[model samples]
Target: MSTLVVRRAPITRVLRSELRMVLRRPRTLIGLGLLALVPVLMGIGIAIATANGEEGGAEGLAALVIGNGMLLPIFALSIAMAMLLPLTGAMLAADALAGESAHGTLRGMLMAPVGRGRLLAVKAFGVASVTLIAVLLMALTGIISGVLLLGGDGMLTASGTSLPFLDALGRVLITALYVTLQVWALAAVALAVSAFTEHPLIVVVVSLGLVIVSGVLAAIPALDWLDPVLVTTSWDAVSEVVRDPIEWGPLVEGGLRALCYLVIGGSIAYSRMLTRDG
Candidate 1:
């Protein structure tokens, strides 16, 4: 008898292939393009309002961005996080497992020589990358459009103080990372859902429904008791970065909450993958 050897694929190569498959998808490209446009549209809207002497009506971060161009990325992220950002994450998660299953590729992947747990990890990484890219694209476009339309006026803190360019950029990066964590939590939930379904549309619908329901529940004063468990409850904490001293309390709490979701979601996904029948 002759002994034969089989080599496992390198993890880096698997991840790179997964990422390429994700980025080359037409829907992924289209979604990213649209996300990049959001900040540009916001910048244009603000510029037109300023030209028309309507800046007085602006409020919240939008008002702040008028005077602080560097704040535009933060402002756009604040708006996008509520819907578009999470939706993009949800879409990526849907495509990770459910889409592949629907196309009959998931069964093939499950039957491959790679361990199922490692396969789940690769899918999760691909989804996570999509969310990160979507956020960075929006931020980059926001920064460019803000500079062109509003000028780089540094950044204004909630305390009515000004921050230098580098300091403000650091804050913007922190804010982006914070928002990305929250969206990643959402994507994890979607990925778990994806493992349970063969229909990608079902994953998207269920994930989005969870988001809307969480938002609604968070809005109810009576549901204050549920604040600690609700996912969207701490989403607004991203604004804490805009303060002069950078409030760490809410941000830390929000990040911890997201971590909990990430753990639970990943656990469920892995369990399902292990028990799944090919």
Candidate 2:
């Protein structure tokens, strides 16, 4: 018998193929379109605030900061995680094994000179890249809209203090980074769920259900102690980035918790993908 040679594919080639697949899907395109509209929505919100006598300066900045600072970022982060992020992650990962199996291509692909582990790794990396891109796009749209509509003057902080325009911009950027990390944690959960199911809708529903349940659990007064334990609790950590005195405790703890979720979720996904029958 001839020896079977396993040739590793370039990561770039795999990523390119993944992107093409993602772009071709109408659902993915719809998600991207919605994310693009965030700026317009923010503009409308700002306009309404302005019409209510909130214009640029310390008062304008204060109003903008109070209105959007934590709240806007939280909304952006939640929407990205609850909807767009999961949609892309589930599309890629659910399709990874199930789509091929449905089309009777999995066996053929497996017979090729590629190890199962390598194939899985490529799929995981592709899904992750897509998730990050979606999150970054959302943040970009939100921040630009906020600055333009709210007027990039001084900023009124959560603690009733003011900062220079440049400083406010820096805070907004840092908040965006935190939002991105939170979305990454959500994407990891979707990927893990995707690895277990053959139905793409089921994967999406399950992941979303987890998010909703976490949110609910985090909100209950009796579960006050459990709030810190829930991954969803950390979703608002970006707000702390802009607060005076700059409380790093919540952000730091949140980051650590999010990292733990990513590790656990990724481990589960890898194990399921490797061992499950295609």
Candidate 3:
């Protein structure tokens, strides 16, 4: 008598297939398209405001981006981190597992020769790819539109000094990377929630609900003690990048907080996947 051995698929092959599936989805394309357009619309609106002698009427980041195109990506990233990027992360994470489970495809994957851990890794890769792509798309569009509408100029630092183009560009890239990490943390939590339910909507709702609750908790002065534990509390640190001296304390703190969430969420999802029926 002989035992049969099933061959496991290569990781690259699995990851490639997963990415193709994710990138080809209509919803994915549509979501990314919308994300890309946001920065363009923002540039147009800023241009219009400036043309109307309303440049001084703008406030905060908007006021800074009035003529400095290099700041546009940073401005767009700030807005996205508040809500849009997190929402995208939740939706992609939900579709990664819950949507597949609802459509009966997850069982097939579970029964395959692939280990559950590897399956989770592949799903994560796909989700991360979508999230990263979404961010990059926004950044690219912001750059193009800002340069066209606002004029290519050095970024104005919070200290009222101007940075060289290369330096400003580097800062924008760093901001993008930092924002991506925050969204990844949220996606990890959504993945954990997705592991327990076949309803994609539940994953999105739960993930976003957590975000909203965190923001609200962080805003309350009495909850100062809780600020250390809330993810949203550290988000304001993103502005530190554009500061003249570049305050590293808050940025480092925020990155570490995000990593904690990533580890916790990934661990929970792995544990549930190990014991789940499919």
Candidate 3 residues lying further than 4 Å off, grouped into runs, are: 1-5
Q: What number of clashing residue pairs does each candidate have, in the order they appear?
A: 0, 0, 0
Best by TM-score: 1
Q: Residue 11's C-alpha lDDT in candidate 1?
A: 92
lDDT tens per residue, model 1, 1-278: 37777888899999999999999999999999999999999999888888888867667777788746788899999999999998899999999999999999999999887888999999999999888988988888988888889886678887898888889889889988999999999999999999999999998898889889998888899888987998887889988989988889999999999999999999999999998765
Q: How many clashing pairs in candidate 1?
A: 0
**Inter-residue clash pairs, candidate 2:** none
| Tens digit per residue, CA lDDT, model 3, 1-278 | 29876777787998999999999999999999999999999999989888888855667777788888988988998999999999999999999999999999999989876789999999999999889889988888988888899985778887798999889888888898889999999999999999999999999999989999998998889988999988787788888988888888999999999999999989999999898776
Worst window of 10 by summed lDDT in candidate 3: 55-64
Per-residue alpha-carbon lDDT of candidate 2 for residues 1-278, written as tens digits (9 for 90 to 100):
49986667787897688667766778667867777676457656656866787665544223434345333443455545545554555565566655656676666766766766677667666666666666667666766666666554566676877777677667766766676666667667766776676666776677677777888888788889888667678876666765787899988888888888788878887787677666
**Which residue pairs clash within candidate 1?**
none
Worst 10 residues of 1 by lDDT: 54-63
